[model samples]
Target: MHELWFGAFLTPTAENAHTLMRQAALAEDVGLDIIGVQDHPYQPSFLDTWTLLSVLAARTQHIRFFPDVASVPLRPPAVLARAAASLDILSGGRVELGVGSGAFWDGVAAMGGPRRTPAQAVAALAEGIEVMRALWTPGGPVAFDGEHYRLDGAAPGPFPPHRIGVWVGAYKRRMLELTGRTADGWVPSSAYAAPEELAAMSAVVDRAAADAGRDPALIRRVYNVSGRFSRLAGPGFLDGPPSLWADQLAELVHLYGMSVFVMAPTEERDLKIFAEEVAPEVRAALGREQRQAAEPGTSPSATLDESSRPRLPKRDLAELSPAQRERGMHLVRVHDGLREELAEIRKGLEQVAAGRGEVAALRSLINRLTMRQNYWTLGSFCASYCRVVTTHHTIEDERMFPALRAAQASLAPVIDRLEEEHEVIAGLLTGLDAALVAMVEDPDGIDGVRDALDALAGALLSHLEYEEQELVEPLARLDLDV
Candidate 1:
C-alpha cells in the first residue's frame, strides 16, 4: 500500500505573509505532514515562495516544505538545485522539490525567462531535470550540453541532507510521460486535473513508466485539492461536512492510488478542519482499505449457502425504459458499496494482530507526527466505519425495506428474509462496535475484534448480494418511490 500524507497549500502573498505563516505552524501543531507554498514570482502581490518557505521551516519544528511547483523557467536549473539542497540541509531534510514546465508564457517572458513552445518547454524541463540531478549527486564536476541548457564543469556542491523527492506538476500527455520516466513523484492540482480526469492522466504516467522499464508504484502520486465546508451536501466535490471531505479523499486513495493530499484551503478554518478532522479520518479509512489491499478479494467466511437464496421473477431489461432500468440499478449500486465495506472488515480482521505494525513499536518512544496517525487508525477509526454500516442498516429498516414491502406483496418472503438478515447484520454491527472499544482499551485484544468483524462480513456481504439478486427486477417494475 502507498504511504499516506496530508499537507496544506499556502499561497505566498505579501499581505497575508504572517497569516500564512501562522497557518503553517498550526498545520504542524495539528499534525499535518507537509506545507506547500506556491511559486508565482512574476505576480506583484506575492512574496517569493522560497523565502516564505524558509522562514516557515525555521519557525516550525517537524512539518516539511515544498514550492508548490517551482517556476523553473525563471530560475536556472543549476542554481535552483543548490538552493533546494541548501534549504533541505538547513531544514534538516524536510524539503521536497515540486517542478512545473512553465505556464503563463506572457508572465514568464516578462520576468526575463525564455518563452518556449509546448514541445520546447517539455524538452527544456527534461534537460533541466538532468541538470538538477547532476548537481544533487556527489560527483566531481558536471558537464552537459543541450539545446536549451548547457553546463560546463559546474562543480557539484553541498549535497542535500536527504534524498529530496522531485515531484512534477503535470497535466499534458507529454508532461505526464516525463513525470513517469524521470520524476520521483507526480503532483497534480484539482483545479487542472479534476477527480474525473485523474484516472486517464494516471494511465498515461503508468504506461510511460512501463515502457521506460520502471515500476509505476515507485513514483509517488501527490494531489493538490481544494474544498469548502457546508452543513448540507452540494452538487460539486468536497462541498459538504468534514465527514464528506474525509470520505471523498479516502475514496481517491482507494480508487486512484494517490496517497498525498495537499489541500489548497481558502481560509484558516479550512486548514484546521482539514488537519484536525479530515486527515485523520482519511488515514483510519485508508488503514482498513490497505488491509483489504494486502490480501485482495478477501471476504468473511460464508454462513449461508447462497444457492438457497430466493430469486424474484425477472422482466426483460431490454424492454424496460432507460429511466426505469437506471432506477432499479440504483439499489444494486448502493448494495455494491455496502459489500465493499464488508469486504474491508473481513480483510482487516486478519491483520488486527499486526494492526499497529511497526508504528506501534515507535509510538511508545515518541509522540511523532506520523505516530499520531497510527493511533487514530488502530484505535478511533473502526467505530466511525461501524457507525456507518449501522446507520445504513437503520435507514433500510426505517425506510427502504418498509416501502418495498408495501409496494409489492410478492416481495414478502424476500423482504422477510432480508429484514431477518438486517437484524442479524445490526447485531453484528453492535458486536463490531463493542470490539472496537475493547481493542482500544486493550490493544492486544485482537481475537474479539477479529471474531466480530468476521461474523459481520459473512452475513453482510451475503445479505447484500441476495437482496440485489432478488430485488433489482422488482424495483424496476414496482416503480415505487423507494
Candidate 2:
C-alpha cells in the first residue's frame, strides 16, 4: 500500500457502484493513491461490495481499490479470502482490504443475523484475520477452529505477489491489540475518537506489534478529519482565503502525521467553491511548507511564485470598450446562475443536517445532501467556466473576431492563444463532468471529486484570466472599428 492510503467509503447501489468506479479512475487520473467502497448486508438497495470492487478493478488500470473497512462478521474468512485474492490478482496487485468489527447495527439485525457484542466482535475479527492470512498463503491448507467461525481444510490458491496489507479498524485497547498482532495497518474511525484517543490507540498498536515480533514501522495509523465547505462567513472564519485555510490545515499536518487528508465538503456547490476559491492557495502554501523539510536550505522567497511563472493579464475588462456591454451581460448571467445554484445546495445541506425528521430518514437525507454537495461543488466551477468560455467563443466568432480581422491582422497570434484557451477549458469541462458523476452517486467519491476540482479550478481560473488578457488589447482596438 502507499505510505498513506486515502479513500472514500461508498454504499453498493448500482448508481453509486458505477459512480464509484468512475470516481476511482478519476482519482487515479488526478494522483489520489487509493479508492474505497463500503460493504453492507441485507440492504435491498445496496449492491454486493466484493462484486463491485471486481468490476472497478477491471475498469481501472492503476488506481488501488478496496473496502475502506469491511465489516468482518458478515463474510466468513474462507469466503472473503478467495474473493480478496481474486480481486488482488485481477487488479494486478492493487487491492487492499480493511476488516473491522461490524458497525451498522440495524443492517446486521435486519438480516435476522446475530449481532455480537463489541468484545465478541473484536475477538471474531482477530480470529478472522488469522484464517484469511493462512488461506492467502499458498504453501498450506488453512484450518481455524475459532469461536465465531471454524474452517477445516480451507484453501485459497495463488497468493498475491507481495504481502497483502490487512488493516484492522479499531479504537479500544483489545481491538488495537488485534490490529498490532495480526494486521499490517490500523485505521480507527474518527466519528467520536479524539486526538488523545488516537494517540492512545497508536501507542497500543505499536506496543502490540512489537510484542508480536512484527515491524512497528510497517503499521500505519490513519485518522479521518471531517469538515464542511459551506459559504465561509465572517472575518475570522477558517475556510476563507487559501492562505488562512492552509494555516489551519497546518495543525492537522503537525499533530496527526497526516499524509492523506480526506475532505468532505458540506455542500455540492461548496465543493466547487473550495476547489476554485480555496484549494489552490492552500496547496501552494501548505504543500511548499511541508516540502521545506526535504529541501533544506531553500529560502522562503524561492518558494514564492516567481516572475518567470506566467501571470494572469492584469488589464481590466473595462478597457475593452467595444465588447464591454456584451461581456458584462455574459458575466452577470454566469454569476446569477452560480448564486442560485449555490443557495440551493446550501439550503438542502442545512435542512438535511438539521435532523427535523425521523432518525433513519435523516440518515438517508444526510447522505443525499452530502452526495449532492459533492457533485455540485465538483461541477459548479466547471459549469461557470464553460458558460464564460462558450460565451466568449460565440461573441468572438459572431462579432468581435470579424470586426478585429477587418481592422487589423496584427492581433491574430493573441486570437490563436484565446482559441487554445477554449480547447483547454472544454477539456476541463469534460473531465469535471466525469468527476462530478462519480461523487453524485457516492459521497465517498468526494475525495476524487475534490482533487479534480482543485486541478480544474487552477486551470479554469488561469485560462479565464489569460483569455481575458489576451483579448483585452484586441477589443480595445475594436472600439475604433465599431
Q: Say which candidate scores most in lDDT.
A: 1
How many Å off is the CA of 402 in candidate 2? 60
TM-score of each: 0.62, 0.53
- lDDT of all predictions: 0.76, 0.57
lDDT at residue 77 of model 1 (Cα atoms): 92
lDDT of 2 at 440: 66
Q: Which regions of candidate 1 are displaced past 4 Å?
A: 293-482
Q: Encode model 1's per-residue lDDT on 200-227: one tens digit a residue.
A: 9999998897677665655789999988
Worst 10 residues of 1 by lDDT: 293-302
Please write out the lDDT profile of model 2 over residues 44-119, one tens digit for every residue: 7877878777877777665576676786777877788777876765554577777878878678778775588888
Candidate 2: 10-residue stretch with minimal lDDT: 298-307
All candidates: CA RMSD (Å): 24.3, 24.0
